[model samples]
Target chain A: MKNIVIGRYIPGNSFLYSLDPRTKILALLILMIGVFVIDHIMHMVYAIAIIFLVLLLGKISIKRIYLGLRPLLFLLIFTFTFQIIFNRHGELLFEETLYYSPVSIALAAAIGIFWFFTKRFIKFRLLYFLMTLLAIGTVLSLTLFPGTFATGRFAVYEEGLFMALFIMLRLIIIVTLSTMLTMTTKPTDLNLGLEQILAPLKILRINAEEIAMIISISLRYIPTLLDEANKIMLAQASRGVDFEEGKMKEKVVQIVSLLVPMFIISFKRSDDLANAMEARSFAPGRPRTRLHVLTWKRLDSCVLALSFLLLVTAILSRVLL
Target chain B: MAIKFERVSFQYTSMDNKGYLALADINLSINKTGEFITLIGETGSGKSTLAQHMNALLQPTEGRVHIFGITVDDKTKKQRKIKLNPIRKQVGLVFQFPEYQLFEETVEKDIMFGPKNFGVSTEEAAKRAEKMIEVVGLDASYLKRSPFNLSGGEKKRVSIAGILAMEPEILILDEPTSGLDPIGRNALLDVFYNIHTELDKTVIIITHDMNTVYEYAKRVMVMREGVLVYDGDPVALFSKSNIDRWNLDVPDILGLTRDLEAKFDYKFTEPPRSRKALFKALEGMLK
Candidate 1:
């Protein structure tokens, strides 16, 4: 539930905070391009440097970045494991013949059991999860058996490890960059910026304002829907859901017990919201007056120029370096 | 005691205000049976937070909460994951919009959800559902209807029945009768009161309705600014001079009692329960 902290804008009066959201969005886009354009892992130092500089300017804490990364930890680990196991590009760093003996299997089970039991007792849950992951990986790859048994070769290649870390780093950068954008920019301003940016789509007769409104409204409801969903979760939990502990089949049922209600609630809410909007004489795609209009200042242009320079540096590095 | 809060303080750190306390230093206890406790408060006064703590839906941020004698504290919860299924079973919490919790295709299956979740056999759960639908004053035929399609009141009753089907020893409801019309609210209150008396279950309701507090509650707890300002008999607590500071709406009966005391200069031993009772008390005072 805490992971869905998207659209949650942290208010600050820093330089990044004051810049036009359009500039920030453009900056985010260019920086993202830069991140992807940089093929070498070391070339990512430019993206990392700018991000850190943005972080310092924005007053966005490392803790917030850590929180942003937390929900993707499973994804990161899975990719790392997949790359380590499957990718066979570079020379093998290590090759081990592993056998799944009864004792080793029992040891794996014990590790799982130990993690399941001891996890609640541990305060640093992410570290504990990683520790458990490491333990399981070690048991899977390194365990040896004496008897003639079913065995497999576990090989760790240099390129695979490097690719895995690179991908993970790439993902972290993208997530952190987006997190920074959302964290710094208010949702309404972000929507206005989106509309402004999408204005060129008018050539195809696509209404940018409508699209922006849709995105804006959707962004607005994420927290509300999440709050409603959290309430429903607690309600279900009270009915003996044990959301964190149920079996696979029961968990599926439990999920339906959650999702259906959520679906119903969202529909009901949207209906009411639509009526409310209509009552307020809100017509989508209609030119609307704003209480606080977004303005692009000289500072915004400077920031955009900086982003352009970063992108050029990235592209130049790709060609020349 | 079914539930006890020993200096329980909860803070909602999810919000921007890091120092905002939802529940501050709450030390209270609910009996295992035969108590109708109404928790009254301003909006954001932590009544809902307090209610959630009763069933271990929320553990205290500070201090210990004993749910059916199982202590939930920083130390204990950190030591091991406490099995809360039994605790949840024994304490049914019907939330503000309990109807939203309903997800089953039919009312019967929806009501059976809680009991089945607690591992009651399907037959037994069905039986409990039947009994509880009746208990919540819903007809048996309504059980066949989709809970999603029912009127607001009916849906609420079905959701309540879902909890009641669990046969919790302690029932904690957060503003159970808030949105209903007078008759509907009265009927729902009557259903809860009957459950309180007949089944002899401890009933704790967090209600904004001071009338509900004055009418049904044996023990009334008033919270203001996350602090328990009052906890005592409904009549006695409402009569206190400092009750006004909480900015609470004076219950109609309490208002009448205060009026009678002011106008007639007669201090009644009990707060009149109804208009007729008020007249009777006035008649007695005149005599």
Candidate 2:
């Protein structure tokens, strides 16, 4: 089922996993912003180097990282084709009459960079330096390079293709980095980090702890919900309910029937969870002590400083440059 | 006054070209009152399918099912279908893992659902819920708590409470004690016994537990591969050598008593129901 991918975090321990979730989150955010800061090919080369260094430091296997890219192939191909067909200002590579322009080359280069950095982030073994290098390389390749294929009637332009590449790279980097943060960090750490990050809302009388509790519960239920859904699906199948063998509309109806039991079970589980929480004296406003306190280490401080610097650089490049 | 199936045959549709026959030419009748019937069968013995027919959950593919003089058939009139609801209301079915039927958030709500669905007033339903809560030997405080939060035994009790609130005349439980710990199973059996003795409701239990059948049931129905092989007194059914043929086991105490009777040339005036009963019978024979 598609839901199998939703919360499928493989349990492991490595340098990346040991880093505080807050540090990883902040670092990834910085790397994503920094990817857009580079405009030249040399800067992109540096970015690629940084990304690979990060991957090396993380100690993640290449095969594991490649698995994350499997689902994104179609999206990459689609973006590449769209850029090649539409961009119309670069030198024609294929035929002068067919508008086979330089933008196609740039688009493909951008996709390669996007795929590399994003795949590295999700795999969690890549070092920050390696990730940074990959990110910059991807951004520069899209921005400065000419299309590989162009024609006389419609030349594939470099600028528009770069823009498309930049947008896609940014999205992929952000999502993959976030997914990496989740994969490496324990759920408890993630919740605590969210609480700390959202602490500013306390000034407005918002309960950060309560919000954190909700977030933790939501994360905890993801795997549980998946398991319950699988069980219900199996149960329905045993009753001669063929979900896989059906037309599109019939499949939808079969899925609905499958979902009914899942929803019913979830509601019951939620009720149980609510009661269990209440029984444990867990009130919304009550202050609770943490077993694992969050403290900033030297590495965390470095990551924090780097994040702010990257953010500032990105904004400056956008406005001043 | 109760359900009677005459020469019923049922074939279950199978994926293979050669289909499976679930029930074959079975005839049985459930009495109106004071009947503790146990259906004993192996996994694919069509016992569950037969039980479903009692509540009109499944109509016999062949032959007639008459419940209180109303014949249950494929061509039964539409207006008569409405009558089946009342009959179904009377025949409360507790399926395997009956606890899964508990859908409401609160225990009270879960218990009241059946009564509410059957058009009972809120006040009456609440009253019934309280009575059932006591009947199931659960605390009143559990009523406000979630059914899912309770222990396994408590969840089973809540499920029973749900069905009991409907005030069914015939309560049918399918493997009510399966998967329960020994203590939990004993407590559940006590609940079933109380339902039979205190409420005077006709009880039909579907179980493979020969101990349960030997201890509580007045009548036993043995099914083997979709055939009703034995339908008679619990003692008579246990005494039959054909039990081995049906791949059924007699209760341990009953088997022991029978062995002693054959070997020592002695017989108890009445068959023992439990280990304690067997000891007492032995003491009586010695005296």
Candidate 3:
């Protein structure tokens, strides 16, 4: 349950924390665009380096950054695999064919056995399992599928492998960097910053304040809702709900038992919140006084200038090199 | 012993990675079935934390907890497959505001959910559900109604019925009458009383209501700031010289008894445990 780590803010005072919310929001946008603008491995390296530099300056724990990345690990693997499979540029890396001989069968069985046990025992089991899947896929293509690895026609392109790395690294850096933004920035400031940044959208009649309020309220209630949901789960567990020891169908039923109550609770909470908001006279679009007026300091400007420079460098590198 | 905690301490780790001790070196034993024990404390006094340990819901950070001889401690960690289902089945915990646990379409299904989860046959589960609904002073017809449709008090009763359907030997309720009116509170307390006396279950309750404590509790455990301050017969608990230091109000009847003693200088033996007891004793004295 703790794995739902998004929207969790850890209070800190660092360079990133001190930056104006608008500056932080803009920097995140530019950096995300820079990630996809990568054309060379060097560009990827530079992007990763900047991310690490920001993380270091923020004094955020690497373990927390890694924890933030945990939920995306599976999606990262999927994207990486799909990139390798679909991209067919550059020369072939390897080609092999194994006929149905006793030695080949024994080798396949041995690999399967190794994979099965390593998958169960290894610490980084998911990564090891992915490698095992790749190995088994290669072997199966060689023995079962004739036009692929079986006929020595199956090939993994070097460009495809490099591209996949670039994409995966790009994804991880973007997510980790954005998580840094959220982890350091208070939700109130985040909402205010977002409101400030989207002030221009008011020209088009969009209610930016209400949108910001929605985001802030949602962010604020995340931990509260999570805590409530956890309590409910425990209460149900005490009532003999063995969530871990159920069959798939029974597990679905158990999940319904949890999710339905959660839905009810969230709805009731929102209704109560709306009532409270109305009682407090929180009318939308009314001019409000700021407790902390966001003043753009010289450091905020310097950070913004540096990010823009990085963004330009990223684009120039994509174009020239 | 029904439940035993030996030097049990529980530490909760905050997001900042600092461990705060919630329960500290609590050594206690509940030995008998049909023994009504009430744990009374202010909020954050570790009353609920201690109650949770009784059902193995929260494990001790230091020392051990044994629920009906099922060891839950460092040794259970080594074994890795010590089934807690049996222990949990025997020790039913009805959480505060437990009505929130109800999610099934019908009250009967919600009530039977516990027994069914424990692998009881549907028929037997239904039977238990009907019986528990009656036990909680609800009609059997309530079995088919949506639990969501019930009033706050009725929802609480249904939720209690869900736990009672498990037919646990040791029943623990955390502030079971918290938000109820007087009548609702009495009705719920009656359900627990029946569970204790009639069904012969060892009932442990955590409450802040001193009146409820005096009325129902045979034995009372007092906790203050994670420490077990007092544990004994409720009558003995109230008579202690330092009872005022515990920061608990004396139950109303007992307060009246003391007031009567102060006014008349009567050395009354066998102080009343309930309003009825006090009234009967007062009539006897007048006659």
Candidate 4:
């Protein structure tokens, strides 16, 4: 819950924070398109640099985004492995001939068992996770040798490696860009910005402002709800639900125990909030005044122009080059 | 001692906060039986942190906390062999608005959940559930009903019953009576009072209510800015001349006793512990 950095607005004043949320959101959308167009490694290197620059502009530490990425570790590793195994391209990076006899398989099985027990004692989870993946990769490469377990070809291709790195980089860019937008923009300002972005819906009788308010309020409460979940988790921990010591079935039961309380409490909370808002005479589908209105300044326009330029160059490189 | 803190301190680490010192160095001891202690402090005073340390929910950052017989320190954390859940079963902690934790389908199942998790047989847990519901002042009929269908006060009782069903030797409640109406609060307090008297468990309650302090707390421990500044009899706490320094309101009974002493030109070596004690003192003055 603490590592959920997206939509977690840290209070700071800087170039990114000062940019209009509308501009930031639009720029991120454009940059995402740019990311999809750019297939070259050099272009990705540039993109990574630009991302760090944006991080600097936003006054967000690299550590914050790094922590945010931890939850995606499994997905990243899975995708990397999937791409490397399936996508055969330009040149072979490695070709190996190996055998998996009954004895060798038993040896690997022993190592697997060793890993299963030793994994708990290791505190550095990321390194351990990667080591486990390496073990899995080794297992996948092992094949039934013809006639008394002879050696077989195990291989990797150059473009397969490139593509795997590219896709993972793409994922990180997408996640980081969105995180940047959320980290800088205040929820209320994000709401107003969303209203402006969705203003075209007014022609179809849709209330963009109301929809935006709902979106931002829910986003604002994500962290609050997470904290509530943590508290409830601790309370249940006290009741002898050993989350760390549970079997998979018991873990599911414990998690269900957590979610039920979260659902009930969050519903009660929103009910109280709705009543309080009504008591304060808040009316939906009515003319509303803003405490602080969103503004698009000259700098915001410049930022948007730069994003548009980036998008054009990316498309040109993808199509023409 | 059931629990002992030796120069214990705690720092909270999160995404943004590298570490915030929530509890500073503190030393304290709690007995295993028949001790009713109230932990009182202003908000963010580390009272709750101290309470958490009892069951190893939050271990010390700087020093060791001895719980039952197990010691928690840097070494224990490193080894990670000794399970903390056994300690949890011994020291039950009920957080504020514990009603929010009521999740089981029926009230009986909810109460049984704790004991069953601690490895009690289902039948035995059910029997404990039957006993605990009544201990929290609920009728046995509540056992069959869905806990979600209960009223706020009833839900609160059900949650506390859930904790009690485990039959913890030490019970810690964090502002257990906060949201209840006065009548409901007193009734719930009486439930705990009876538990203290009958079961003889070491009960620690963290509260902002000074009146409960005056009434039920045999001893009061005051926390300020992550430090335990006072630990003694509640009567001695109220009698302190600079009581305002702790930002505590003089409990109503104490205020009335003070006024009675001023108006009647009476002084006793020992201050009255309760309204009934004040009444007896007043009778003695008249004589």
Best by TM-score: 3
RMSD of 1: 4.5
What candidate 3 gets wrong by more than 4 Å, as runs, is A3-7, A61-64, A75-86, A91-106, A124-149, A153-156, B74-80
Q: Is candidate 1 or candidate 2 better by lDDT?
A: 1
Instruction: Give each prediction's DockQ, rounded to 2 decimals.
Output: 0.57, 0.04, 0.64, 0.69
- Tens-digit lDDT track of model 1 for B1-287: 77888998987766654566888999998899989999988888888888888888788889999988899875654555678767899989998896569999899999889999998999999999888888777789998998888888788888888898888899989888877778888888988899899888889888888888888889999888889988889878876777767877788877868876998787886668766788888788888
- Ten contiguous residues minimizing lDDT sum, candidate 1 chain A: A140-149
Tens digits of per-residue lDDT for model 4 on A15-93?
A: 9989988999899999999999898977887888988987887688998788778778789989998888888889999
State the TM-score for model 2.
0.51
Clashing residue pairs found in predicted model 1? none
Q: Write the per-residue lDDT of candidate 2 for residues B1-287, one digit (tens) a residue.
A: 68899898777653233557788998988877788889998998998888877876666768878887778865553334435555667778776654346556788987886776577999999999998998777879989998767877678788778888888888888788877788878877888888888878789999989999999999999899899988989888877787787888879888788899999899789988988888899999899
Q: DockQ: which candidate is best? A: 4
Mind giving the per-residue lDDT tens digits that candidate 1 earns over A1-321?
Answer: 554555578888889889898998998899899888998877776577778887887788989888878888889989988999999998889887767777777787899999999998899987998889778768866546445357788899999988898888899899998998888888899888988999999999999989988888887787798888889989999999988787899999889988999999999899999999999999877778888888989999998998899899999999999
Name the lDDT value of residue A314 in candidate 4: 87
lDDT of 4 at A34: 97
Candidate 3 structure quality by residue, lDDT tens digits, B117-222: 8889999999999888888888988988998888888888888889989988889998888878889789889878987888687899899899989999999999
Clashing pairs in 3: none
- What lDDT does candidate 1 reach at residue B236? 81
For candidate 4 chain A, which ten residues in a row score worst on lDDT? A139-148
What TM-score would chain B receive for each of the candidates shown?
Answer: 0.92, 0.91, 0.95, 0.95
